[model samples]
Target chain A: DTAVSQTPKYLVTQMGNDKSIKCEQNLGHDTMYWYKQDSKKFLKIMFSYNNKELIINETVPNRFSPKSPDKAHLNLHINSLELGDSAVYFCASSRGVRSYEQYFGPGTRLTVT
Target chain B: AQSVTQPDIHITVSEGASLELRCNYSYGATPYLFWYVQSPGQGLQLLLKYFSGDTLVQGIKGFEAEFKRSQSSFNLRKPSVHWSDAAEYFCAVGPGSDMRFGAGTRLTVKP
Candidate 1:
């Protein structure tokens, strides 16, 4: 069984188009995270939710918003996608808020044309 | 601000040869160190993590890392390289609540 999973393995949309990526974790973890990996392969943490509560909100723009319906799910919604938004988005989860080890999903490749 | 640095952008090694990937970090306090691997079209997988202990941590896939406090370095080493092990490796550092990652090093194993 996949520990952390994200839907829409590949997403393609035009500029200004809004979209959402769904993520689910069966590991029963308390903390979930959203990360962005750019073309240069630099992974950056975007947002993190602990027990459905916003724990870490990086300096990401307001166009990006993360919603956690529960501790097992955290979805990312983009208001208006831009050309620069082309990258791989990864979903991860940890056993606890303070745990350093994280299990990541297969990642969703978002392409904004 | 906590940050990670992976000096080598790419590394090439021969199969059955030893390999080492360097990682350095700058943090104010005792930082949590981690090494993760990413295969083609796959998400990152945790190889090993150093929170607090003997500083030598063993991980899956025959990977291990040693954390040095004075040097502020955590390096990943393997006794022998396999062709399947050729992939991108990332070094990360966690300070308190936030975690930051390095740019990653791409390894190519030649047979």
Candidate 2:
């Protein structure tokens, strides 16, 4: 079984187009996260949700909003996407907010023209 | 603020040779350290982690790492390299919800 899964393995859209990526985890984890990997392969944490509640919000712009309908699902919606938004976004989950290990899903590569 | 650094951006090795990847971290308190590997077109996979206790921790796929608090370092090593092991390796530090990852080191194996 795929512990963590993400939708739209690849996305290509215009700079002004909006898009959303969905993520789900069957690990029964209470904490979920969204991470952005840039062209340089530098991974940065964008947001974290624990049991559907926002726990950590990094310096990401307001255009990127994460919503967790339930503890098992967390989705990311980008508004007014810019060219700089092109990167691989990965979804991860941990047993808890303080868990040391995180299981990651196959990343979604986003390319904005 | 906490941060992780992987000094080597890329490392190449022979299939049967030994391997070592260095990682350094800066945190105010005792840190939770981890080593993750990402194959081409794949997500990150946890190779090993260190929270406390033994400084030397063994992980899956013949991977191991040693945590040195004095040096603020956690480096991953293997006795021998496999062609399948060629990938990007990342070192991360976290004690809470926020985890910081290194820039990652790309491992290339030569047969």
Per-model clash counts, in order, read 0, 0
Candidate 2 lDDT over residue span A36-109, tens digit each: 99999999999999989999999999999999999999999999999999999999999987845999999999
- lDDT for each residue of candidate 2 in B1-111, tens digit (9 for 90 to 100): 999999999999999999999999999998999999999999999999999999999999999999999999999999999999999999999964889999999999999
Name every residue pair that clashes in candidate 2. Answer: none
Superposed model 2: Cα runs more than 4 Å off = none
Give the CAPRI rating of model 1.
medium
Error of 1 at A29 (Å): 0.8
Q: Output the number of the lDDT-best candidate.
A: 2
Q: Individual DockQ of the candidates? A: 0.64, 0.82
TM-score of each: 0.97, 0.99
